[model samples]
Target: MVEAMAKAKLWTSPGGKRPDATLYAAILSDMRKGKGARFKKPAPGRFMGA
Candidate 1:
């Protein structure tokens, strides 16, 4: 799914092809592939619910 999204040339939107969506898809794709290290999962019990 991430690969498909990343390979897409454009994201169809009501406003037409959106580069923002493409950028987001690319980010998500990278994260899915474990390449994004800037963002890390919060430690357990750090959240309000926990």
Candidate 2:
């Protein structure tokens, strides 16, 4: 995730392409594969700050 975030800084969206969409697709894939997206749900009234 850190690597992707770093790479994002160097990415440029040409022709109105959405780079974030691609990143999200990869995240969903990882979630489906039981990888990085196994985070527990945040408690009520407790925000998960970025």
Global lDDT of each candidate? 0.43, 0.46
TM-score, model 1 to reference: 0.36
Lowest lDDT block of 10, candidate 2 = 41-50
Query: Which parts of model 2 are misplaced by more than 4 Å?
Result: 1-4, 7-16, 35-50
Q: What shift in Å separates residue 2 of candidate 1 from its native position after superposition?
A: 19
Compose the digit string of candidate 1's lDDT tens values, residues 1-50: 33453469433433437656654554445445554333333554221111
Clashing residue pairs in candidate 2 (N, C-alpha, C atoms within 3 angstroms): none
Q: Residue 16 CA error for candidate 2 (Å)?
A: 8.3
Off by over 4 Å in 1: 1-16, 35-50
Task: Report the lDDT tens digits of candidate 2 across residue range 3-44.
Answer: 456567833333236666664454455456543453322564
